[model samples]
Target: MSAPANAAVPQAEQSLRDTVLSRGYLRLLLLCVLLGVPIALACFFFVGLQHLLQHWVWESAPEALGYAGPPWWWPLPALVLAGLILAPIVTRVPGSGGHLPVNGLGGAPVGPKELPGTVLAALATLPLGVVLGPEAPLLAIGSGLALLAVRRSAAADAKARAVVATAGSTAAISTILGGPIAAAVLLIEGAGLGGARLVALLLPCLLASAAGALVFTGFGDWTGLETGALALGELPSAAGPDVGDFLWGLPVAALIAVLVTLGRELGRSTVGFTRRGSKAARTVACATAVGVCITAYALITGRSPAEAALSGQATLAELAADPHAWSVGALVALVACKGLAWAVSLGSLRGGPIFPAVLLGTATATAFSGLPGFGTAPALGLGIAAAASATTGLPLASAVLAALLLGGDAAEQMPLIVAASVVAFIVGQLVRRQRPEGATDTAGAAGAAR
Candidate 1:
């Protein structure tokens, strides 16, 4: 045989080995470990950056100028600045500001050109107090980063690419909300697959999510931010599923579904209206409207504008702890203002939708808790489950996220959360069916991912 032919034999055998390894579970597990580390680190950095920026903008900068709290008008210019920074990117860049959180998660993998735009836009809107979350943008960033890493390796097939992307997404969002299971449910639901195919996709997700959570916990300990997951500082004694709890859960779900659907319709309308103008012009208009809504919340409730803006992460803990802190009137003002701001975010800003939806649900449920037979815990779980279902259109995911948010009490509240989620899911489905032919879905991001 010729020398060239002899060399080809080894190369072909090597290629065959690589392909087999990539397909095997062992290789996938190995890749999960390797990819999870960097993805987890990246998530840490991304989260840390958001935290630092929020502090600087809301706390440090204000204190520097000798102000006790930011003036009431602070959100107006801050949001207007959000428009200036994000307008061009959403319009001029690719990926359309990273998949529009209102559309749900997981699309064709984002490209290199579009990835930076996602990062830039997220950085701009979130820290400045736009009513959005880090989940959607983080998904895109993690997926984009994963694809880049795999392109250099042997497992570059379509299946491999999909797995890598899924893993990256799991890692990216692992610690943002509650647990790895939440991330897994979200990716599985969003993928819209089933049977053996779903299982195949789910394996990598589980591994990656586990790794990401471990890393997030470690990082939190190292840095002392203690923010890898959501926690309720106070807990009200929860009653198990009572007849009244189940009976009233339906009405609560029905009411929240209607409100959320209305918000969705508003977002759709805003999108149409904004499309009429230039990108920058549309962003400015939407952002200014957002500012107005937030200002209204602050003015009406005598709460900080921060309560009305951002992803609602900071506010969720407090609201969960003390449902009685605000009167019914204050709670109503909060829901109205926050919902309006959330709608505006969907129409204009670039961030995730999930956190804001949960916040809205938390407020509504807490308000309803004042009625007969409903305790604070039950109301919170029901409200969260219903709002999540309405916004994300995923019953299972919404249930899981709601239960997990209860932390150590998750097991005890599982039945109630699941029931509420189911009720909300049915109501949401019925309401959606009744919409006009061209009606839009509710605006939000990852199950609290936004």
Candidate 2:
């Protein structure tokens, strides 16, 4: 009887442990859901703010002054002004105006103290026509906000706080690029998390993401503003992948890897190139260089300066909507100018590298579609994937993003996109020189490229 009673105690303890874990997970799920609403709301507001400023500064104000479009020189003073405003914030504020997105996508969590600097930097650069995306800034914002939330809540343990912070990031990024799955891929690959730890992180992320996406959808409908989701709109009918398609995709991916690596390396060099200068001087000089790049694109393509501005989201939609309308010359100009702008932005501005890369990828792929046996759809898909991989170093995530962006066309194009992603990622690794650990050279300033 004594032995049986002792065994019962062990079973009881085990049962209690299992019950506690189950309850803990459930509570976490609830926390994620609750957090999702506010993060989504915050994202909605941020998007609106960016749009409002872009319209008044880049479009409405120019129109109010009676110009049909901003002249080629329009961005010069605009960028200078942005640099002036952002210099102090990035240099003096906590978080260095947020980690440069070119360095990598989600790194350490942004503290509440650093959140303001991140927001200020993005607001200063993005609406003023810096060729960067909102993704990185939003990631920081989400992480910061989540950390703040956890600080205010009952979660005092280190593990709980980290989980909540990650959940916040996932919720914030869920709908911005495409959906929860994309967010999952980005966080998983970018963080290098796997196995049981990956599963734990992923559940809260998925839960928060689902809730956040729902909120974004509902709020977007209510507000009637585009929620900044990537949609390829329409794609040409894709033929199944053939040997010839892979052959072309291989070269295309290689080219993309080189272009991305070269651009990032150039951007990284700027950190040291301007390190000795005052923050204001560096910011002004870099912004001016970006303005020059945009002007060159306008002059070369004979398009409005606005076409080369922003994060390149609208331009990507335009390319997908009417590929025939964009001459090869125009596409080349866009890629060249945007690459230059991307480098400058990476060096000085506060934004993500994602949108510009996507646009460049689309243009490059479309331009090369005339190659024998490289159909339009496969080339376009491969280009987008390779370019994304080049920038991000996360081939799997990049492939998913590219395929999903193709919208209805993904079913037929997934194989080609996957192949391109793998090839580009491997080639990018070969072409990219690893940064020495703890060195504050340009590459460290950038993060990982994506």
Scored by lDDT, the top model is: 2
**lDDT minimum window of 10 residues, candidate 1:** 441-450
Clashes per model (N, Cα, C within 3 A): 9, 6
**lDDT of each residue in 1-450, candidate 2, tens digit only:** 799999999999999888668967678778878988998889889877988998888888888889888888898888888778878887788888887766756456787998998988887779988888888878777778878877867654777777777777877777586888988777766665553365345435533553455456456657999866875664665555565676787798788888887888887877666577686688778888888888888888888877788788888888887887988898888889988888878767778887788788878888887778777777778888888888887767887888788887775677677767777777777888788886432211122212
lDDT of 1 by residue, 145-174 (tens): 878887777746777677877878887877
Off by over 4 Å in 2: 1-21, 194-237, 438-450
lDDT against true structure, model 1: 0.75
Error of 1 at 265 (Å): 2.0
In order, candidate lDDTs are: 0.75, 0.77
Clashes of 2: 6
Candidate 2 TM-score to native: 0.83
